[model samples]
Target: MLAEAAKSQFSRDHSDHLALVRAYEGWKKAEEESAVYDYCWKNFLSIQSLRAIDSLRKEFFSLLKDTGLIDGNPSICNSEGNDANLTRAVICYGMYPGICSVVHNERSFSLKTMEDGQVLLYSNSENARETKIPYPWLVFNEKIKVNSVFLRDSTACSDSTLILFGGSISKGDTDGHLKMLGGYLEFFMKPDVAEIYQTLKKELDELIQNKLLNPKVDMQAHRELLSAIRLLVSEDGCDGRFVFGHQILRPLEISALSTKPSLFSRTESGPGGDNSKSQLQTILTRAGYTVPMYKTKQLKNNKFQTTVEFNETQIMGQPCSNKKSAEKDAAAEAIQWLKGGAKESHEQVNHMSKLLKKSKKDHL
Candidate 1:
């Protein structure tokens, strides 16, 4: 009803009515399109529309001042480059009614969402576009291409802490964060790492269909399968080292055959080690989720059995937090109490002491 009232109050004679409606529809569409891809192209349609609609919306809101529907003073929204970028990150990671931590990185930069409003920002330009000044409310940044990404809902946490770790700008980590908890976060155990395995199986089937491998041994088939995955998921964010979704590969070691194998050898060899997803699953397992690799079972052929484990500390990071805000609040409370002259006392002690003395005298 409130939305309807807001819509109804829009004026027909206003030159921007058409533009405002167009902008609203465009914003809605861009949001929907934005959710479709874990990673999007440099010039996707949604990016373009976001730029357009954002600019127009700012313009339309400005026009509101002349008409007096609102006070000449209009409410303003603040924007920070990092916050806007983090918002993009969350949407890329997705918020599918569950606890998730979204992670992303480039060749030299890495980042993750610690809190709810952080977004993923991308630019395909050789040098990323940088904006310094604040714009009119309608002004929107152009659609940018994402290099890499990860989005995950978190586990059921008693306390909301979006821990961040292992990202140093010098070592090339660009971490951002957000948190939601209790009633705000809904936990679901559906579509865990098992889905990733299923996806791999489908791709393997496709390779078989394309005559890329002999079914009996499948060495070449396996290689082809691995190559396909490397191509499809190798972008900065696509790799799972930071997100820790699943550990399908082994770490790179520099021995004669001790070197880390590519992602292909890792998944086919078994589900642990350098495989990033496997590590992620291990992290989830330690956190007490019933991940399948951690729930070991006998293999039918009996050639080999796999068990996955990771040191708790090796995981290195947790989600982000609102603790900064919480700290500020605590400090404020302390200050307020000090100003109000509140105090704690032991008044009951005086009466208890007198009673004790009388009782002692009677006993004597």
Candidate 2:
């Protein structure tokens, strides 16, 4: 359908083609996932309609050349695709009553109107705050880097982002375990969480370079950064799909920076409490990733209690208020609990205790 649209060259009787072009124009505006593919598609489809108009312009130019159509001495060089000149000619005719008015007034052409009526920038008040200078990241500005990770399966392939990292590279036994977890948690967690982290790192670099302190930047970079960060914190099905058998929500001890010390530790608050699973879920969601809660455990008295059940397991927690504090906790606990399990969780608990002690000593 796209190819056919791009090549057609006819001046008249293209009502059907025009209608399709218009329909696609409408579709382009309605869809949210309309990224590069959508833009390319709409352009390809619209090109066909332009070809039809180009055909008619050729005929019109032919009449003007060669001493003119009526008084055929020498027909003008009938040019096609001369939009600017053609538009000017048409407008000139309308302005001044002359013999050319007949040609310009013809129904075959109407200034090759744009598919979109008028370009609108920042239509709403909020949009004005959100809009940024239109510096598109074109191919000229883009640089691609190939990164890879060797999976324990002994099969090496090109992977843009590495999944397993740090000293605990996936060993044969761990790889098998992770594979099982992958199968179970594919829907609930993001399988490519490490990749997501790498992406977030890159996005953060970009944000640092172009976003953070730029006063002119109203909100575009903030939105993009928010999305990138969301993806960074989102649970990559590694745990949610019951991956690894009832994954741990918080990696044991959250960081010392936790303002309330209850963000993830307050089990009494319930899954939707101020420091509950819902709060953590919100932080991840805002950052750009979707996390579905499969289960919940109350954290009263700083200990997980009970086997909480839900009618549906797919619940998303609300955003947390103390993200920076949570971030500190996440970083501190990453190595402590992520690799090990109940033991590792306990180690993280101990580690936090030491961290507090060290801080107290520094103060003293």
Candidate 3:
């Protein structure tokens, strides 16, 4: 009804109507006095539309609190006092798994979802088409697929928001390395930072679970946890890399092996040194193994098994219910085989050498 009223009022004037709609829909200025709002107030056919918006905002807040979606009042101001980081953290809490990060390059700005593929930012977004984005991460409400995927009602966010409100946190392949969203994103940080992130994640999970079991839980405790989370996420001067899953899997150039021999060369220490995804890739490449490709086979129980193949030979097969887990299993098996092969060959060569030496002595 409000939309129809605004449309009818501005039907005759296209430019004013667009400006008014955008301002009304998008984030408003922090102050009570806004030139755009004033202009709309004077030109608008009725004051009821403005009143309706205010009422709607209040109702929305009420609903959020009642349903335990939020712990406290949300900041309306976009200024420094508004705590943008806190707002982002709260958004992450509610949005949880439906988050994305902005990827800006010379060519374009795209949003990469955790599990799903990349998506283009909605043209209506404030960050869209900007030469540079203010923040590296973004949390989106949802995605819609037309000709291509696009994020709707997206907001700029920071790494801290993800650490606090993102999905399951797991230890990465190496120390001081952590992965989120089932290895879709990787973070390299100090041991302390990793510990803090894990601790906060646990607290947030428990809080959310408790709230679900009983919405009438103490508001004081709820607010305190949110406060701690906000503080943790707001910390600065931390060093880490926010890497997309695809970027991690991107193959290294063949020429890079010569320049970075230490990274790609087979280790004398043994296979268990580092069987990480990248290391596995290096070992495979060195052994003349082609880039591993996967084929999915559906089973009778509606489950899937992923098979990793190299040069038409099946290196490993993984049976799991989900595609992601199955793929991980297959890759792990391939790495194990590559690592074990080296050890077996070393033993075989040593045994052959001993036999050759003994036979030479007998002949002499």
Candidate 4:
């Protein structure tokens, strides 16, 4: 499917929706329809699915024409359709709130959605075969659960695309911060940068609305805004990553924590007293990774089970009667592995502690 979508002999690094467009267009433009079966057989693609897609596409075009969304000449609508960055931005625009953070590692990467937490892409994806994607987020089509939850076809996207092309944005909990999806996704940038993105996004939305209303309207009038958008997405320095398990500490919350010295101490907190969850997150965070994620599921026996995940390690504790205790037990189980009960988690946290103490003494 990837090779077919890419239209390339060699495997490529692309997870964009336009690739799908280009592939389907290529199929339609093929001179010899006889080789269709051969192509499908060689590439492990299903001819039945392809035929359905072909039929659906024509119906879509007819519906659009009937609805006055487009005229017979698609040329006007496709003026910037080949612009890969803009196409991805458009996909993100239409697919708002379906975005997930892309955290790359040396050999592989992981995905985390706002609601689902840790996820994986199917092995067949071109993006899945690659160790890194040079973008901050992926606007996915959908997700499924087999052995584990997996994200289906997705497009790698930059921060600028999301910020300038996604849903309505709002101010965040702190200065120089912006948020979306009811504050599940947060962005921090210079205040001016935020303003620029918002300004450009507003103009972009208006231009689109105008074009939809008047298909033949001259879009060249907004060429400046178009140029700015093109420039931004192309040169985007993706200075962001997946911080999956982060939680903000409010002022009152901070004050309460400060009053309790042992709260930060593992020896004191130690997997009990609802502090296991906090301790698990703090240790992982101090180790320079995102906070650990906790997933809770209701069992058939009227019990709840929780799994705590971090650093690609997923540990599920014994089930409990309620969600809170299940999460706490899972966190405690993870803490056991992190804090030298098994290894790395505790050593790293202890290492961070030493660094903190050294810095404090040096200041004194």
Indicate which candidate wins on TM-score.
Answer: 4
- Once superposed on the true structure, which residue ranges of model 2 sit more than 4 Å away at CA? 1-343, 346-364
Off by over 4 Å in 1: 1-52, 59-364
Candidate 3 lDDT over 1-364, as tens digits, reads: 5644544443221122233444454324412455545545544434467557768978987887878756674663223334545655666667767666655433344556755666776765545535545455666677888998887666665666777777788987655667776655666566787887788889888887887788776656677777777676687322214432111122223233213212122222222243334434544443223456777778788777776765444543445788765665555555445333344544533422322222211110
Which of the numbered candidates is closest to the native, going by highest lDDT?
4
Model 1 TM-score on a 0 to 1 scale: 0.19
Which window of ten consecutive residues has the lowest lDDT sum in model 4? Answer: 355-364
Off by over 4 Å in 4: 1-11, 32-34, 213-217, 239-364
What TM-score does model 3 achieve against the real structure? 0.49
Cα TM-score of candidate 4: 0.61
For candidate 4, give the lDDT: 0.65
- Scanning candidate 1 in windows of ten residues, the lowest lDDT window is 159-168
Q: Is candidate 1 or candidate 4 better by lDDT?
A: 4
Residue-wise lDDT of candidate 4 within 156-206, one digit each (tens)?
887788888888888765445677887666665667877887788888888
What's the true lDDT of residue 211 in model 1?
Answer: 44
lDDT tens readout by residue for model 1, 1-364:
4543333332121112232444355455656787423212322234555567679867876675444333344333222222322332222223223223222111122122323233333332111221311110011122223453322111111110111110111111111211123212111112443334345545654654554333234344477656544333322232222222222223222132212221122122112333434433433332223432221233344322222323211111111134332222222222122112232112222221222222211110
RMSD of 4: 14.3
The total number of steric clashes, by the backbone 3 Å criterion, in model 2 comes to 21
How well does each candidate superpose onto the true structure, as a TM-score?
0.19, 0.17, 0.49, 0.61
Predicted candidate 2 versus true structure: per-residue lDDT over 1-364, tens digit per residue: 4554442321121112233334443444534464635554644545455446557655765654432232333233223223322222222223221100000111111110012111121111111122221110000101122342111101010011112110112211221222212221111123365444445555555555453344244444477665544342232232222122123334222223222222234332221233434533432332223443233243444432221112121222222344433332332222222224344334444433322222211110
RMSD of candidates 1 onward, in order:
28.4, 24.6, 17.5, 14.3
